[model samples]
Target: MKSRDYSQLMQELSEAYAHHSPRSAAIHQTAVQYLVDGGSNALRTIEPFPPRIIAARGAYVTDEDQHQILDFWQGHYANLLGHNPEVVTRALSEAFANGFGLQTGFTDLLQVEVAEMLCRQTGAEQVRFTTSGTLATMYAMMLAKAFTGRNLFMKVGGGWHGGHLWGLKGVGYHEGFKEADSAGLPASVMKEVVITQFNNTEQLEKDFHRYGNKLACFIMEPVIGAGGLMPARREYIQRARELSEHYGVILIFDEVISGFRYRAGNVAALYRVQPDLMTLGKAIGGGMPVAAVAGRRELLQLAGSEHGGKVKFQGGTYAAHPAAMIAAKVFLQYLIENETQIYPRLAELGAKTRKVVTHAFEEEGIHVRFAGDRLTDLPGSSLHMLLFPYQEGLELSTPEEVRNPHVCDITLSEKVLQLALLLEDVFIMHGLGCTTLAHTEADLEYLGEACRRVARRIKPYL
Candidate 1:
């Protein structure tokens, strides 16, 4: 490759991005007075300013500046059926119209339906609702300890289970650094957690042996989301199942991003690797904040079946909120009914998109590529495509190479690409791009066009 122009390209793109959304910049500036750092979620707060979304319908979002941009972010990958989907919205509307109360502080009939659907889909013995994926994972870890009578938790090094205290260790891999991701978190909590590299069975064995009888649960995402969209190798997952059984440790799959993204409901069903406990979120809500911790009856029952019974399973004021349950029930049932159509199309779109993007960069003499799960075996098809900017000695032929932290520079590449794509009228989520069913061939063509423009501009940084 020719000497890349990292500085000049960035300066030009920076200026162009600033020019692209003056309204968003203004909005964020005003927001800083009330909202911390101009936004609640640190991830969505972009450098210049995150786009001020005014309206979102189907595959597009209209920014505060009135720019009708085609959106691939899909509400941070929560809108698997696309924004304001008819079925979900209708369900919500009918519930509200029927005098269904919000946060009624009582068991909801909708919860029963939603739980039944989740149980049927995942073959889980029991299901319990939560307000967010963070809570689901946190409760899941607690339940594991309760059931197994163990103290330690094991998780993949670069996995993102949530922002909970126990789940904060080793979120992003920095060579020679194995510390927790946040400040102000108790150092004591990090000690009880053991981190192992994804797709590395050898390291897993070592960690298991190191933790031994104290290890309560081994929790992981089927596809590592934040660090990189790395899919666990089939053999590696099987090994996890085998070891969990041998050690009597509960296995928990954090499917917050993968639930229903692969084949209607869960990756475990698609991959045939069952876990003792599973956390479901993101797409299940269709836009609302909803999640659930589901698993074997024996394990979940340890939390207590009756009110004030044995152990506290956990109950939030917003857990199983009637509106969210109705929406989730409608979305999950629809997805299950249309699984044959929805999943394959998503996988195909992912494969086609990877080709379009890679080809776009190649044409500009850029060596850019997406990192994991290529072609039909779309393990990372949770609508989040982890971009791998060109790097040396990075293997693309196998799934086992997920542990290589140098697979790409996500921090810089993701930020730059988001700005570039935004300026091109394509809205991506923190540069973690996604695809929705509402995304058509024309939208894809626009994506390719935008990528071609971005690649040419980023030629110096290649």
Candidate 2:
């Protein structure tokens, strides 16, 4: 078989995309005059400009070009109940109708209500609400450093905790996981953050042995997001817990993407290894911007008034906004009440989509593997990411392997496939993206057919 020409293919796909969505292209062109890179978020800004979405509901988003595109990005994988889920929206509307509003910057009963729900659901002794995953994770790290009196922290390569200071290193694969993700970060701060390989227990143990005494914390995602959406092994998580305990390091689980994803609460519960602190976001807000750092009382109390305000994590002005809190409360209640039905159905749909899409590509003589399933063969994934490995027999177990161009066709999956599918009126991030409860069998069928069409169109490039 001939090698794929990803650059040539991307050029062709970008031309086709611009031709199909002229309005979006024009909107992006206008946006570039103000917004950096024509967007606030870098990931959303793709080649030839991204489609300017005007409205979104259920499993589809309407672009400015009047195209109703089938969406799988699903609000950065936060829309478990789909865009503007009625259960959450109606509750927010009712709150507004009852004279409630947003961002008053005062403590309200709604904050306590949602915080109590989170504590009860996730086995956390305390909870502190924030506005985003970045702030939440940053606060968690600060708490860890303050409590442990250590400076060094450890995170796996390609694990994206957000755009915060502690999260700026070892995130993207483009630099081969060697340099800081951003340009302005201090070298002194970046050096204190030790990097480790995901799911590699031996390397983790070695690092812990070398830097465990000086390390304040070891933060990781149980279901590694951005890195590949791959779940860690049971033993690996168990070992992490054991080592953190022995080394006096605060183990922090960054569950921004995984929390409330596999179940009603945190995915840490599934691993049976509770970290000292867990950062929650994305799905927990019910499509609103709400995030939190919750865990043992002592650590969380560092941010409290009684503790002399060690961490400075009093939260921002939008912390526990009334409407967002109500939305989160209603969404969590619905998820808890329908846990058995919601989770199983999500897993089933995700598995079905993965299998069908893989089959679609295989029919066109294309070989691809997905990185959504658990290493233990567990059937609980609601995310699917297709990867084209360099060889037929190689397994994608780590972030390096998943993002390395020599090991896998990173450009083919991230850029070429993305542009190709957008022309088919389908949107995906990290390949197939996440499955929402609002997605139906018919939607899955549409997605499968779209993949098949995309495969045939791009087959000759390979």
Candidate 3:
């Protein structure tokens, strides 16, 4: 049996995506007049146009064409309790009715409550709120530079901190990860940011030895997202802590994806490695727009007036909006109280999903690797990404390997499968996305069936 061409498969899937999503296609045509690339976020914009979502509930999103697509994106992996969960929404409604919600432009008790919860749960001595992960990471980098009196920073290849100055390099998988992720970033500043490989302790040590003095911080994700769902090896994390301390480099864990997704707090705590600074978002907000930088008191205080505001780390206009604070506080309280039951169940579901989906594709002779399963010393991970191996026996540990086009089928997982799954009325990001509390065994079964059907179509092209 001769295999079909990859381009042919993609063309068929794109045509199907456009045919079933006519309204979305039309909306995208109109949207291009106002929004760049027909969307605001680069991730949300799908090829042949993305589905225009009107409403979301539980594990499904209602598209403009009134299609109920089972969603694995889950509000950019923030909706731990699912879209508009009653626990957070009900609290917001009550707060609004009592005239205590929305942007107050003033300090409120809710902010303090949420901040306290974050500090206590994550072992942070202090915490500050911001509006997005980008701002949280940008401010964290600035704070690190202020504390260390250094201009340089380090990040792993394929790690995405945000669209900030320090985060714009070493993100996408270019040859050697040398290309700038954006155009506007100053070349001098970009040069200061060195790219290291995830879980490669030898390279990490070499880079630290070379750039230790001038580097302000080493920022990375414990459980890698976007670039790959790869989890950092336990030894790698310990070595990073040791090297950062020895080199006077602040270690910042961008736990925005792994923060509450693993447990009620940050995944770093599970590794038993405390970073100097940690940026959190996604699940922390419970679907509201909230992000925070939490760390040692002295470093954070650099942003305070007493220190002459060396960092100037305050968030912009809608930072810590009263409603977002209340939502976060309520969400954290619920997670804390139900920690034992919630996490174990998510772990069970995640394990089941990985197994079911993997078996479904393998039955069709499709080679796939799922990256977000429980790693050494870190358990209860619910997030996932499907990587199609480009060759037999290819290691899937590091982002360098994961993003390398020669090592993995980047287009197959990132595009072709996504569009095919959408045709099955399912939405996933990167590949197979995160499993939230809203997902059920039934949902897993549905996803398995969808994969089996899609694999049948894609197998011919393999």
Candidates 1 and 3, the one with greater lDDT? 3
The models' CA-based lDDT, in order, is 0.77, 0.89, 0.88
> 30-127, model 1: which lDDT tens digit per residue?
99899988998887787667888889899888988889888877876788878899998888887778888477888857889889989988889899
lDDT tens string, model 3, 264-293? 899998889999999999889988999999
Lowest lDDT 10-residue stretch of candidate 2:
371-380
How many pairs of residues collide in model 1? 3
Order candidates by lDDT, high to low: 2, 3, 1
Question: What digit string (tens of lDDT, one per residue) describes model 2 on residues 1-462?
Answer: 346676777878888888999999889889999999999998898887999988989999999999989899999999998898899878878888888866676788888989999999999999999999999999999999999999998999999998887899998886567568888888786788899889899999999999999999999999899889889888888999999999999999999999999989999898888999999999999999999999999999998888888789978988898888988888999999999999999999888888788888998888999973436634579888899876877668789888887877877798888889899899999877898988889988888898899899888877
**Number of clashing pairs per prediction, in order:** 3, 0, 0
- Candidate 3, 165: how far from true, in Å? 1.1
Which 10 successive residues of model 1 have the least lDDT summed? 396-405
